[model samples]
Target: MERNFMTTTKPFVIIGAGIAGVHAAESLRNEGYEGRIVLIDRDTQLPYDRPPLSKEYMLGESSESNIYLRSHESFNTLRIELKLGVEIVSIDAEKQIAITSDGTIIEWEKLLFTTGSRLRQLQVKGSDLEEVHYLKTLSDANNIRSKLDNVQQVVIVGAGFIGAELASSLKKLGKEVTILERMPLPLAHILGEEMGEYFLHLHQSKGVNVITGDSVVQFDGTSQVEKVLTENGRVISCQAVIVGIGVIPNTLLSDEKLDVDRGYVVNEFGETSLPNVYAAGDCAMWPYRGANIHIEHWDHAVNHGKCVAKNMINEKSAPYSAIPYFWSDQYDHRLQYFGHTKDWKSTVLRGNIEDQQFTYFYLNESDIVEAALLVNQPKNALAVRRLVKQQHPVHTDLLSNPDMSLKKVHLRANEDKVSY
Candidate 1:
């Protein structure tokens, strides 16, 4: 397909106003795109940060006004039209127009889908109880926080990032928290059994009850959530319940006209299969290391928005090559992970794992760093990111040494100063 090089008066319509959509709009203005930008979302509130919804916001440490990504005046200064609480019912790629639910049609020269993802709700018995909640939006956090006073014994389902983070926050609030996971070890698939066991023990040592190899079969309550029943015939009494199993990409606007797999399939330039259209954030799966992968982290969304916005403006497209990065704060431990890899040949550990401060390096056959996990080791984060991005071989002996710095580990190939 040929690029739309001609600048038109029509608006550049963006479907969702989350991190990706907001950044895309800002990047468009910064990239000298003076055309009309329409940012739309079904949410009534201004675009807000989501990571805090389960952590600081739920703990009441962060205020509602602090969670917003941009001020109202900033949007006006950028000349970006904010269409909050409006849902785009349908769109015609052929006609280059979109129809809203309230019988409104919007014309556009280019369209970007930053629709993000929706929470994966538990569909079992009593899942619709009043006290049961899923933390995804600022409003969800508000709803959960409003009832925290009455919620003494809280049951958290799933031991993923959100669930673990919520457990940490609730435990800090003096709530008796119980986390139920179907897998034998929490986060074993993503962080491996060793690191997963560390997390299991970390939560357990912090007074949070971590139950593995069990699943919630039903939520029993009269009006609100009173207790939870597990598949192993274990009934746990709780005043409230929070479910955070996962999320599914919101690709409803695709309407079967665009290519869809795990998400909207896009190339390196963030261009969808359809012409004059693009997708980013959690809803778009772009090429990564010869595979199309969708990352649901905040860092990826910010960089993806910036990369795609440049492509939308320039006739020459560039590949999105930003390294995938994300961080989680559970109690005092800040877990930072860099790079993306599902498989590794061997894992190397630096510092003492039992001390709760360490870094784990996932290496391929060539001794090149594929990913690294830093547990409470903030000093090693930047160096680890560089090693993963450089993809250079390193000395394992030096890497495991506590005295050796990671910035110099890649230089060990030479005898004098080490290779740069």
Candidate 2:
């Protein structure tokens, strides 16, 4: 038997019309959900892809229409009521109603929060000056892109994926690019120090001035930023600056009644503590590998959205167990990563790093593959993903040999069962 809402006309409302929200709406309809579905967001523009905003979109290679997640006709065809430039001011969970910023009360049978995240702002002297931008939405990208023609020198205030991608794009645009990272090595937290050094060298070789172990203490200029002051007492002159330090989960809607940690706490099925409430994407921390983790990546968001939508309609859907995957494109190199591991005893290299074609495999004490990073080696992507999932023990000698394929290494079952 269907639920009570299935028999009525109450809409299934999803807050935040991002990738996750859009995917969830489509999944609901595809799963035979016949009720009214509404997707809401405070952003005035149509939902667009964010990853390209720092790359192709910034390089003037891709237009706004090309980046849009869906066209108007597509949403209309799916019967997904999209409410853009609309903000939900408050929610009455017991009453199953949400009050909008315009004082419109919308009743819903189930509520889904995919609010995503907000960029971490830089707070210091002259920070409020014009030309200091943070890229998160289409509007933010437009703001940065609009000023590129007048900008000859660009300073980026982070060495994370977005910041690095932006540096590559800006350098390609013929601007003198400078990157300021507080960490000793860029992306060391995720990619490790060795790979992080590789990125530092990659940027330096392209004529990008990368200054590590220093952070922006202040921005100097009148109405527009003309220079940046670092904590290490180094002053760098620049025409414009883009801050891509990181992002914090946008959980402003969560009240005392809702559970929230680093993000809105949700189970593997995307269920909250409250009945008929769900959360996904960057704003949700779901169970993974015996602990809850928030994976702020495009691929994870797409998968999580689809998985949650299934459980929203049918309560007995399978728990989400997809392996964590992420990719980044910088200059002419493509890096693909599969699985996640914070603790690994050894890292085995299979290919040449100096040639920029290699795969780094993270293995535990028992020689079980936990994660693998493929750089410019697209041919090994499928095999690497499968190897990580299988979690089979393999000889380091086989793994280190370039001729020994990953697919052939884990063929034999180990007498010792792998334990996490």
Runs in model 1 deviating more than 4 A are 1-8, 255-257, 413-420
Write down the worst ten-residue block by lDDT for model 1: 1-10
| Model 2 clashing-pair count | 0
lDDT of 1 at 358: 94
**Poorest 10 consecutive residues of model 2 by lDDT?**
1-10
- How many Å off is the CA of 188 in candidate 1? 1.1
Please write out the lDDT profile of model 1 over residues 16-117, one tens digit for every residue: 999999999999999999989999999999999999988888888889889899999999999999999989888889989888887677889899999999
TM-score of 2: 0.96
Q: Which lDDT value does model 2 have at 92?
A: 79
In order, the Cα lDDT scores of the candidates are: 0.90, 0.90
